[model samples]
Target chain A: MSQPQPTVLILEDNPGDFFLVKEFLKRTSLPAYEIHHTERVADAIKLLQEQEFHLILMDLFLPDSEGIQTFMKIYPLAKQAPVIVLTGLVDEEVTLGTLQQGAQDYLIKGEYDEKLLEKTIRYSVERKHNQELIMRSEEVSRKKLEALVQERTRELEEAIKKEKLLVDLKNQFVAIASHEFRTPLSTIRFAAEYLHDYLEKIDEAEIRSKLKKIEKQVTHMTALLEDVIMAGRTDLKKILVVKSKIELRNLVDKIIEDVQNSTRNTHQIELNYNVNSKEIDTDEKLFRNIFINLLTNAIKYSPGKESVLLNIKEETGLLIITVTDQGIGISEEDQVKLFEAFQRGTNAASIAGTGLGLSIVKKAVELLKGSIRLQSGLNEGTTVEVRLPVATTENKPA
Target chain B: MTTRILLIEDTEDLGENIRDVLRMEGFNVVWARNGKIGLDTYHEITPDLIVTDIIMPLMNGLEVVREVRAFEKQTGVSPIPIIILSAKATPEDHAEGLAAGANIYLKKPCSIDNLMNAVRSLIAN
Candidate 1:
């Protein structure tokens, strides 16, 4: 491969000094130096801008400019070129100023020799190549650092947004709970007052029935409120699960009874408990919430007169509870997002809820090593099947 | 026949309302503001039915259910039906209450009719 020649740009107003540099560089034994000579500062500036030279021979006093000002003007343009000043008029102050403005070496033109010029040209070219390498590396490092800073800034912004969203959600929950609680509590209050005001004059059986209804409602309202609070606590990771041996059949029966009594929509629940009289070791508290959420969803979604079915069986070392509801079913698209936090189905929007029921159910089920699958479409009814490992094996870490 | 009920609740308004309603129904009702007081009164009176709310100031409803169950286990006394009244009526809450030895759990926003049905059914069972 042909080697590239070292290019030297000479900026000297004196033709005698320019000829001396060219003659010295040409006769030198070093690699061929491509000499570019310019006698005026403007032509030098134009030459520096057009081509990249390895070395520049600068004269302190030029025809158009003088001193540090000329060096300052041309130094920026000679970014990759190493500068050597060749001036006949030399003083300590001028020498210091030239060297400070990036001149590699200074020589008095009257004292210039062929040997000295060749050595200066070779040394300045090598030094310029090394400086270029360092500047290139610094530019790369600067770009990488800027990119890293931008990435970290984006991550921090997202975290702050999430935190703000959580705060807003909590505030909304508090407001909704407070507002909702008043209506139920007021009903209980009015019922109690009616019973108390006409206690003596009211028919004994009628008064007793009204009071019984009032008592039941107050209890119901209290339970619902407590559930909302507990759901919040679970979301905050404050609720603890207490594990024990629980009869599956009895658990299903209890859930059926609660759902039947809670919602008076006349939705009958059919239970199919195929598992033998075997008690499974699990956290009953967590299980109850899962069942309650599932059963409530079944009743709420099923058409008023339709029946809700519960099928419980053991398979593959797991206890499976499948709840089927014949109410307004979930669309295919909604099924994908059903278990995510704050995700509500389009059809279920008109129904009263905090949109946390399914999310809480999924969390509780996962805690119990249970997997839930839904089968449904709009108006097709829904069947939610949950499979949970009977004994959470202590041998394996969760 | 006037049936006596023991109510365990933490909130003053809820407790008063429950007490007044039961009294209106011509059934004798005793109110305990917290689970501890309810447990004490349950042992003292042994009412026909026990209605309690979970999440109280001291000795929550879950503890009260456990206490009542322990008392029944020690003595061969007739099992008193305990109903849990709570606002936290997630299926998990129902399972928890039942696991804690509650006979039944009713969620809030429940109708008076449903509550009465639950009370009557539990009493019958």
Candidate 2:
């Protein structure tokens, strides 16, 4: 079977030149081609708009356009079609200028043979096709690079914003630490000073009360320091979950006992245990930290209230504990940032606190692969629920 | 008559200690737990001197000092001596306290002896 014909557009005004180019194309060893002829540049543009062509033979000096301008006019309309200029020997200089302006090749009117014409058209089309492919690939790669740069810029902006937030948090922590420590230190100093100055004049009961105040202040300071250290450890991701077998009921009872004694039995702590198995495998240290912080917070916030409650139960493969209090509860706005380090409720300003308790509890719960939820309202009360998977041999930390 | 002083503080233990020490020194002391209550007591009793904490609920020490000064200005009463006790110990904090009309700015954990001396001298003036 024969190859399909190549379509050609001839934009030469001279009939003699157009006939010569057509005859040369036929006589060449090229495949048969369809020819579309036009005498003026405008007519040639209209023909190009209507149909595509494999090649174009243009004359630099047409009736409506001339020289390099004629080639420029047709060049944009040529699209991917290769364009070769036809010129007389006298217009050699102008023809070379058309070549520079993207006319593929130029043939002198009578000096060129059919073989030369065939070779020129073949090479021009091939070269133009290769140039277009290179341009298209370059465009694709340039767009890909632009998208990559945009993505990197967005990532860099996010990192900068995070860095600024961390710096702000550090400054806030310093300010809070100074104030929290000073309040207790002031109390301790005054109590000690009073005891020294009035040792001989004060009664035994007064002496005991002053000493108790000093001890209490010292304990308060120690707890604050421990919270700061624990927060630092968790922020650094240095804590490891160490699972061990523990009696859950006894452990919780002991924590409640400790909290009650420390508060001097200021509030009653009722514990309700409904779990079937008292024995469980878990990280004892993390569990203790979680409950201690929760219970202490519940009692501390609920001044003048009678009691707080601790409830524990078990679901399939899950252990759930809830601590409820009838305290001055948290507002909705405060609860949003309650678990952030060094954040305190607006109502808590009158109450003494480092605002680190719930944050510490959150980190401990996360380490245990557990989830904590808080329900609270202004003056209504607060209930914190924690759920954890019961650690078995298969799911235990490696 | 015993010299009367108003002590404004929020921390329970510290406030109690200050009140006790002042009483031991033979000055009649009235304690208020926050700035609002302190201001109300200031109006009711018109104590001979005022001691206030900087950070508190309802109002702050600076606002208290400004209000007292404004009251003195309005009523043509003699300006009352005011001492500011604060945990913020920076030079800027001291300037801010004094600028707010406090006669003295003392950092927290200040020596009890120094506080007494300041109280005695300000009363004498």
Candidate 3:
């Protein structure tokens, strides 16, 4: 059998009035109203806080809280509940004011019967459910809107990445094209200028020498075109690794030698071999490329610098190499993007490069099962450290 | 007998200069405007060594290398030593050319010395 019950909280400070309301609720043929009565406003507030009741019967006068102030405290909370005011003889005028402040209904204690009590309970419960329905719909709509906002944010991020890629490709193309053009122009310019002077003085031998210079320039342009095409293929993810064992110290020596010949502003390149006892198993050609790229970057960005250091060491079976350049330091903003493809630091704009060097270094290092990190600040110079697995003597047994 | 050489390039002036330079180096040169025609000419005379540009319409240098590799696999014949002439000179691009079965990948606007050295190495190897 279903329990015939509508639980109602009765809040009246005066004991006589509280008993009177309870007795009237009992006599009322309001089905089975389980009347839970509280004598003080504090008890009523406590009962409401603990659980949800079907309805609240509030009186205008309470020992602790009075009249409208009593209902105001309970009114907001009573919205969570259906509050029907139970007024006394002198407060008939006050009961009308309670209804104006969102109370479900008002009734004089002496005059009310079971019919009035049952009707008020039914109407108050229905009104509370309607307000809850509106609130629930609002909450659902807010969650859906938040989810849509998150999805749009992801799409915008992807679009920004695509735009960045396009810009980098265009920059790479322009740098490569200009370099190619300049090589031939330089060669022709030199050859023509020389020929103008040596055309009569040195005869055919000198002219042939000038021709050779021109030939060299033409070759330079062709190589530039090849680099641009190769870079495009790399962007397309068409490159693969050809692994081989490499001697790290020997490779560094070769790179240092190459850099010395290439750059005019000489910086003392100190190669400190802290990992002299170690060799690494990696693609030899790729190792050469890594060192070449690092050395090139160090040289390019450090124009007119006094000194740079290349420190190599072994720690925990790892071959660590540190290249520190005393030239122009990377700005704080550019440092974050230093290893990213086609990103050049603000201090490096005047330096000549396709901005592909460090990216290549990173990729090559990764293929070697190694890692690289950069440290730099504006005017404070820059240091790039690379760590790889060290090939011990046991690995290279004869 | 003039040694006939095939030059495949998208850029005309660069192609002309390369043809002239190689001619002065005592080789008869035939210029194919792009990689598609360059591959067609490969069957005609089977030129001594092919220098092909990487980016071109219809077919690119990498495709040409793949085709040559396929032909070599079927015929059991020694494949032509193809050198990739490209402006994309990243190390990854070099690796890509090698993976595609080219003998060498040379960046565009190479020094004359580098070009000669590469040609000499391929011939000697």
Write candidate 2's Cα lDDT for A164-233 as tens digits.
8778677877888878888889888889999998789899999999999999899988978888877655
The clash count for each model shown is 32, 0, 35
- The list of candidate 2 runs beyond 4 A from truth reads A1-6, A27-32, A49-52, A90-93, A188-226, A229-238, A392-398, B1-107, B122-125
User: Each model's TM-score?
Assistant: 0.62, 0.78, 0.43
Q: On residues A131-188, what C-alpha lDDT tens digit does candidate 1 reach at each position? A: 7888899999999999999999999999899788777667756644643464466456
Better of 2 and 3 by TM-score: 2
User: How much is the lDDT of residue A51 in candidate 1?
Assistant: 85
**The candidate that achieves the highest lDDT relative to the unseen native structure:** 2
For candidate 2, give fnat to 2 decimals: 0.53
Model 3: per-residue Cα lDDT at residue B61? 77
The full ranking of all candidates by TM-score, starting with the best, is: 2, 1, 3
Interface RMSD, model 1, angstroms = 12.2
- Candidate 2 clashing pairs, residues 3+ apart or interchain: none
Chain B TM-score list for all models: 0.93, 0.98, 0.92
